[model samples]
Target chain A: MPAGTLYRGREGMWSWVAHRVTGVLIFFFLFVHVLDTALVRVSPEAYDEVVATYKTPIVALLEYGLVAAILFHALNGLRVIAVDFWSKGPRYQKQMLWTVVGIWVVLMAGSLYPVLGHAARELFGS
Target chain B: MSSDTTSATIGPVEGAQYDADNPAPYIEAPRKRTGKTPRATRGNFEMAAWLFMRLSGVVLVVLVLGHLLIQLFLDGGVSKIGFAFVAGRWASPFWQVWDLLMLWLAMLHGANGLRTVINDYAERANTRLWLKGLLYTATVFTILLGTLVIFTFDPNIR
Candidate 1:
């Protein structure tokens, strides 16, 4: 009941919160993605145009956000599964949370390499 | 209620022989004191949710795997999965239903799982409210849009 109590408000809880948030975001994105892909049936040109929109700066940034969401959701889900199933996992919950956060940062950075590289090249002559 | 009188009236008895063969009768405790009563004994909501998770999870496994197989492996693999291929697949009622089932199952399963996670984790009352609000919003939006697309997809353009 007191403020700032350890495990009163903990790391695992925040990880679970992020998981649900990301899962919902990814689910919504999936619907849009599936429908957009389905549009290929109507017209090839339309499909191409729709896909071309993804290449825009804003869309690319959104894609990066999606990638981060997916990574966090997946890694945290694994952490949840581990915690639920393993008896001794509670001891390592904070460790696992930090590990997930670290992995997400690394993966996101790696994934952004091409996008960032291209942006740099476009802005500054390479 | 006089606490001193109650204690004085009940003193500890001396040298009671333990009878291994004849045990004392076990009296049922009051319902409120026991705290073991089922919260929703009259309803089937919990049972239905449990069943839904298993059924939806089974269906999701198939739907997701089948989706991946078709999109990633069949025909010329990923390269052939262009606009025309997607349109061709959506042309059939079978594929539409397949997609619809996949959409519904995955959404519901994911939502239910997240609900469980939220209940297990979110401590603050306001935090839970805001998180669930966002979750329900996203889930409803996705499900509605997906259903609309499945039913209203048109293969032809003027």
Candidate 2:
């Protein structure tokens, strides 16, 4: 709310915001995931029927987004630990955040084929 | 040891509240600690929770990423996943333990994280309480359900 607050406009704040958003997203997904997986106890047919939805092109895209969220959260979480514990972490926090972003970009790019390849194949032609 | 002697260099300081011989009265400090306040009541639970976040986080980075790789990135990705795939994986004791540990750690970690968020943003006292109550309930239910599913899973239940 305050104008030009250090945390409000800076990398530290944005990374923290991203972390919370991604963490919440992942947490909710975990609930649904557990319930969905629990269907295996119901019946193989019932389980497969539900899992079929996950294989759809739309759901595959969502899965890609899920991967993005998870990767960011994991990487940034480590950065947060460094800022808390490392003796010189505060001095280099900005650099570490940029580093996290860099690795995230690379990993996200790499994941496209593996995570979205099936959907791409399905949407287009294998 | 030489309290009885006072030299000019060690003269009584300006507005000195008390000297060693005239000890101050025991006024209850603002954040008083007393024998009545048991250690268990004020233990480092929050500190433990904070430590758990970092520790479990380090482990989860491995467990969860590996899980994502296997489930969503390998062997044709989600297209290859189905009841049979899950059954095949769960058939092994190693995978079972991996999943069990992941389930417990991830659930607790997330629940605690959400608790922090709720405490930070929820304005009303009742709102925070309700949100946390719901969070804890869901966490417990999900963890127990996942655990039961893992242990009681019958691959032959086709």
Candidate 3:
């Protein structure tokens, strides 16, 4: 909304934006996660009760989304490092991003069964 | 090539011969700091933060991915996770240290990242101050709480 704030939109700028978005999402999730785990200090039932909510179909979808966010953040983070440390990183950042995306797609596809398979089974009665 | 105009115009200096082989000395931009500038104004905190992001990020890629693999992917997936699963993992000193390192590094890394975001987006000075205040408070609280949980966890606290 302000001048000098937006850069020329491209792979570089969009990746930066995605990185910020995912980082914020993951940070907020970490806050909740820490609080949830602290429930263990309260009682095993309390912790297990909360964790049960995580096994639901709706929450399974959210978990998948979380995985997507974390995976993107992690992979693109490596790309950011390359752009900083490697001599020719800047020159090949676009290529590296595509590579990151490629790997992300594979991992996400591989993760679907592990992450959401139980939810699918519960919903469909397998 | 306009010979008359070129001949009348003087180069950067009267008798200086600037060519590809020997270029003119570089000029410092306006407001650029010099040797005489105060050191306090040029503190290395931002640089350190920048470096910390990269270093912690590389390590987090390993730590977080491995964590996800163990918790979400292996052996019955999320269905297998519960108080008992966590108890089993945290029982080992190896996992305790792994989790401790992860909690610290990820918390600090995320906090510094959000600090940058706040500085960038919060327009007014007071707005930035208050946002960062809340951010720091939450960050410290979460870090302390998580660390306490990890260290003081009782496997048999039924």
| Highest DockQ against the true fold, candidate | 3
Residues A1-126 of candidate 1 have per-residue lDDT tens digits of 685544334575567667768876877677578668656546778887787666555665676687678667666666665665679677688898899899889977876644444434445666
Best by TM-score: 3
Select the stronger candidate by TM-score from 1 and 2: 2
DockQ of each: 0.13, 0.66, 0.76
Order of models, best DockQ first = 3, 2, 1
Ten residues in sequence with the least summed lDDT for candidate 1 chain B: B14-23
Candidate 1 accuracy as TM-score: 0.54
Model 3's DockQ score? 0.76
List model 2 lDDT by residue over A23-123, tens digit each.
Answer: 99999999999999999999999999999999889998899999999999999999989989999898788999999999999999999999889888888
Model 2, B46-150: lDDT tens digits are: 999999999999999999999999999989989889888998999899999999999999999999999999998898999999999999999999999999999
Worst 10-residue lDDT window for candidate 2 chain B reads B14-23
> lDDT score, residue B139, model 2?
95
In Å, residue B13's CA in model 3 sits off its true spot by 21
Q: Write the per-residue lDDT of candidate 1 for residues B1-158, one digit (tens) a residue.
A: 69877766765432234353223445586555346766756688767877786656556546765674575334533334445666689888899999988888888877777777777679998988888888788788878877876787666643
Off by over 4 Å in 1: A1-7, A114-126, B1-105, B113-158
Alpha-carbon runs more than 4 Å astray in model 3: A1-5, B1-33, B38-40
Q: Which residue pairs in candidate 3 collide?
A: none
Per residue, candidate 3 scores C-alpha lDDT tens digits across B1-158 of 69767766865574477653335666789888789988778689999999999999999999999998998888988899899999999999999999989999999999999999999888999999999999999999999999999999998997
